[model samples]
Target: MGRLALEVADIFRAHGPAWRQSQQGQLSLDQLKVMSAIEQCRSAALGGHVLCCEACAHTEIAYNSCRNRHCPKCQASAAQRWLEARQDDLVPVEYYHVVFTLPAPISAIAYYNKAVIYGLLFDVAAETLRTIAADPQHLGAQIGMTLVLHTWGSALTHHPHVHGIVPGGGLSPDGERWVACKPGFFLPVRVLSRLFRRRFLEEFDKLHCAGQLQFFGDYAALANTTAFADWLAPLRECDWVVYAKRPFAGPAAVLAYLSRYTHRVAISNRRLVAMDARGVTFRWKDYRAKGRTRYKTMTLSADEFMRRFLLHVLPSGFHRIRHYGLLANAGRRANLAKVRAVLHVAPAIDSTARDLEATVGALPPTFVCPKCGAAMIIIETFTGCRAIRAPPKPRGAP
Candidate 1:
């Protein structure tokens, strides 16, 4: 198990009581379902069949998983499968990881209007990237990218951000040649930031004017146009932060990066430290560190913990992962074929080994029994508190 895995475990152990106690606090019916689903995931509430390793006589019945996106234990395979499918979309060019973050001022409003705001965040960020990169003076190419929305910071705070993995080049309108970005840079971060801010604010104002925004608590007074304008006035003076990282080393690195967040929940099990009575203790990375090794342990009251975790439960039917530009859903296949032709790259091998080789550094559904040095397989699955029959014992186990 890795450090994150441990931290998640700690959070589970510590916050169970608080979560149960504050069931009335602001949880939605869906959030309740997710919590229940995660609790029973892979447990024997939902029936499952069994498979034991042939070599090791170590025998254990595997439980089925809910396979819900919010279930941490189950997202690995989902992310990996998604990554595998996207391999065909690779354009044989440099890839950039760009992050678009929201300011604290907006995050507060976003907390109440999550689905709407998060959706706007995705659209505005994608539009900004596409618009800027397609400018002739910049790159003038129609780039392709995969975008994912993340709603939580390392400390489980409500920080909304978009993480995009984009190919460095794009297809020319004539489809005659690929246009590559500057070797080390893609778009100017500052310019992208300003444009993103303007677009988002414009959409926000439109929503407010149409009475689409709901204001309650301290924000109730801000529902008035004058107050709303006053609230947004300071944001224009502030610099919105949009930045791109150095290009990924290659396609493999890109896949690895995507897996971390593809089906991720607000938190993972590995981050948990200890859970007996004293709220939840977990490790969080302090990203401000120059050495990149700085980490700290935080303990939150169980009620507060659940509140933070639930803040990220997305609205139903929302698409969290999306493709745009050359990798757009419409013509990804033809575009990918052209890209391969241009690079003289062979088509993907139709073998699991090939996918595994491409993503060795990132793995999915790699579960091992902590009690026994054996792999754990799924035998039964449960949706909520219901129980599923346990799998029968292996052929012969004492």
Candidate 2:
């Protein structure tokens, strides 16, 4: 039996009351779909079947998962597949993890205008990276990167940020040899931060002019262009957050990093501690502190937990995972070819080789009895002892 995390179960438990009182009026069709899908995720609600263990002749059963991208329980395979596909793109060079975040002032706007504003956020960040790196003063080469949109902070708060994993260097405009950025310095954060802010707000102004923005509650004042511009006035002077972590030790480190961030939902199952009438308790990291002081647990009422979780539900069909520059989807193959030729790197291996490595790589040997050398196998899978069991098969059925 698969144990449901209290954190995840709390989300299901709270949905009842939240749906009855959501301020957004009736739950939209898409929201309802996500809610239903998340609840049915690893449960028999979706129906499942039995799979007897081949080695020990042990009978057991496993419920099929919803396989929804948003389900925390179902993201492992997806992450693995993504990493396999990206392995070929890995060059024998350092890779940097950078983050671009919106100030609290704009997160409100982003909440309402998800598709449009979030898209704009991605565009501005990508353009800023490209423009800055292409300058003669900077690396002066085109870089490749994968960008992921994460809408929640560590505590499940409605904080919007973009996480980018960038190659340490790129090809020069002349397309001859590879060019490397200074070690420990990808780009000037202060300058990149300023440029990002200016570009984002400029595009935001256009969005406002086109009447594509919606204002509600405290943001109603933003309906006026002057008020909106004034609302952004503080950001003009503030230093926007653009963070750069030191480059990973090697290309393999890049894959390890992607495995953690790529398929992460607002929270994961391992963090849950308990759930009861009081609320749900789960672990969270306080990135600001030191040592275990960084690891803390918090409890929230079921309703509050659900509310916070649902706050991160992305708009339907939004592409949260994306590639930019030489890694972009439209012409990545051609571009990568050019990049490889210029760098004198060999062509990428076929998909078959990539798939084999993903499924078999880094796996430990299966459990086996120490004395007899017989493989240990599953005996039974059940939600609880009292749950109904499958009836014995009819004689001669097979």
Top lDDT hit: 2
lDDT of 2 by residue, 1-398 (tens): 24764648446845554654664665666666667778776567766555544455554455667777777788998999899888877777788988999999889888889999899989999999998999989889988789999999888999999999998888889777789999888999987898999999899889999999998898898899888888878888988899999999898888998999989998898888887788778899998999989999999987777778877888888998899998998878887888778777899886775676766766644444444445555454454223479899999986
Task: Compute each candidate's TM-score over C-alphas.
Answer: 0.84, 0.86
Expressed as tens digits, the lDDT of each residue in 1-398 for candidate 1 is: 43243434235445555666666766787787777666666556655555444336444555677787877787887887887777656655789999999999889998888888888999899999999988898889877788999999999999999999988888786777788888989889988999999999999999999988888798999899999999999998899888899999888888777878788888887676755476777779888875657688998776677778878888878888988877789988788777777667897554454666657666543556545556556544434345569889998876
- Displacement of residue 166 (Cα, Å) in model 2 is 0.8
Task: Give the best candidate by TM-score.
Answer: 2
**Runs in model 1 lying further than 4 Å from the true structure:** 1-21, 50-58, 342-398
Worst 10 residues of 1 by lDDT: 1-10
Clash counts per candidate, in order, are: 29, 0
| TM value for model 2 | 0.86
For residue 144, model 2's alpha carbon misses the true position, in angstroms, by: 1.5
Candidate 1 TM-score, C-alpha based: 0.84
